[model samples]
Target chain A: MEAIIPVIITSVCVYGLFRRINIFDSFVEGVKEGFGTVRFVAPTMIALLVAVGTLRASGFLDFIAELISPLAESVGFPAELVPMGLLRPVSGSGATALLTGIYRDCGPDSFAGRCASVVAGSTETTFYAVTMYYGAAGIKKIRHTLFSALLADLTAIIVSVITVGLLMS
Target chain B: MSYIFGVMIALGFIYALVSGNMAALSAGIPEAAASAVELLISISGMLCMWSGFMRIAKDCGLTEKLARLLAPLLRRLYPDIDPDSKAFGYISVNISANLLGLGNAATPPGLNAMRELRKRSGTEIASDSMITFVVMNTASIQLVPATVAALRKSYGSTQPFDIIICVWITSAVALAVGLMSSRLISALTRRGRIWKR
Candidate 1:
């Protein structure tokens, strides 16, 4: 992976230069654009982060975990996979943070961490990504995009979690 | 906005406490934060690649080449829009980006594409081209699942490639459904026009 990083960077630089684009300038421009995106997405993302934080602090997530635990168990989802299901939709980073904690608590090779890993690998950031991108673009007619993407996200989570859980168990 | 999220999160946390799972609540904080950082990094890398690739593609006349290559399909899918129109180009790029599983990367292009489409249509309501584009963009075929792969790597997975089948299946189904729905709606509207006359 480390080896791949330099190769990617070099390829991008070559691609940029080949187009008569100054690599430094393009890098600077890209970074600037990235920061702009951060600012543009800040209000939404910060709100999402805070909501996630408060949920954690208030223990709503655990209640969800507990409530969903039985159904999850029936479907072969481990108990630890609960937080992951909730986190998967809202924020990818949030989900990863949960996965890390599971890794720490259950150890890396444990069934719980593996389930979390599979869930993490299976799902995409559904609502947040769609909202941010569409909102930024000033697209009012998001139409059926949201519903469709969410469906995909749900499918990924269910299939990935169940398959991994069954295999591991 | 943050306040609303804060309230919601807090409410969730309170609910968890009431449910008697302090540990799960405790673990959620860092999870959210780390996940946020990881998402940002992934988005940055993807956007950078897209920005650079788009620039190169445009410079090399690849956009035109792609447009020509996709013109027949676009004509069939978006008969309402002129094949030679700028919106056609933007739509192609947006679709291409989505096909690569770079949906976030597709946003800028999608925005540009929509802007172009709107300019061509000159209407407030969705035009046929715009609707078709939306369907295609929404149903985008994802060849790679970058974010998922990254998360898998972070979680210490040895076989992160395991998700390739799932991605292929889900995205393929989504694309098919989206295309069918858009085509069905368009056909119905065309019939409605004849009925009204």
Candidate 2:
């Protein structure tokens, strides 16, 4: 599946040449704009990353996980995966690191590992996506976006546990 | 928001003080920024490559073709969007990229589409079309879940794509819930009897 990336680029370029498009110049233009986007993204990303790193390094993430695990387990979410579900909405990298940790501590085919993968697949970083899109567009009000996004993440988390339990178990 | 950031940092600092881990607190900021730069480098590489291919797709009429193909679906989802607008075209490409599990590829066009929608609407407040577009982008279904696949493979999963079916099911639910909840909230909060879709 990862190989599809190069296949796509090749297909797009070949199709562009067949259509008599100026692919090189247009590509360069896009490269510059892409660079600009990265620049815009970097500051916001750094701020969020620092916050997340500090929160985890201070044991806040573990504390929250410890507090929430029993409640989550009562509702069918594995206690081991609670940190991931909590951080999934707030920090992509944090959840990713925790995912790798889970994979290391538990076998990948284990319920917890499969459930972690499913959760990662099913959810997007809600506040981060909103901040990037709306911030780039300068849309200030952001009305109803956060609420709906959080709901989506919540549903994804709940469904991940149930889906893995049904299919992987 | 800054509220979340400030609270996290301030709490981290206080927590470190209480727990006597000032060393970790002091090191976190610089370390985070360094890693953020490394992430920026990786993300920029992917974006740089895909953005170019996306431009080629646009220049060669692939985007227009894709947009036309998806027109029926787009129109149903965004009845308020102009049928002939550039916003619709970019929106199609964005959704296509999202479907392929290449959201970095989706970002440039997605932002462009947002700009176009805002321009057409001519208001600081987000229009129904913009809200619909945002929800669709955020909660769009992913067939491949490529990132998760790659991570699982790195961690020695024999069948990393096993979760594809579950990804499909969960993301579909996410899209429906996000879209419906946004529309419901807006409809409820609007002040007049003339609320239009």
Q: Return the interface RMSD of the candidates, in order shown, one decimal each.
A: 6.0, 5.3
Per-model DockQ against the true two-chain complex: 0.25, 0.45
Which lDDT tens digits does candidate 2 get at residues B66-172?
65687898888888887778888788888876765556667899999989877876667777777777777656465556556655766678887777777778888
Which tens-of-lDDT digit does each residue in A1-169 have in candidate 1? 3344345456656765776765665555545654565566645554466456656555555566678888867857677776667667766545655665565457545666655655554455666555554554466765555554555555555555555554545
For model 2 chain A, the run of ten residues with the poorest summed lDDT: A1-10
Top of the candidates by DockQ:
2
Expressed as tens digits, the lDDT of each residue in B1-197 for candidate 1 is 35545667667766776777667667766766666666556555555544444444344444445556766877788777776677777777776656544444577877877777666655555555665665555343545444445445555656544545544554555455555665666677789899999
Off by over 4 Å in 1: A1-59, A72-169, B1-4, B16-69, B100-105, B139-142, B159-162, B186-197
Candidate 2 C-alpha lDDT tens digits along A37-62: 66866677667767767876776666
Task: Give the CAPRI rating of model 1.
Answer: acceptable
Clash total of candidate 2: 0
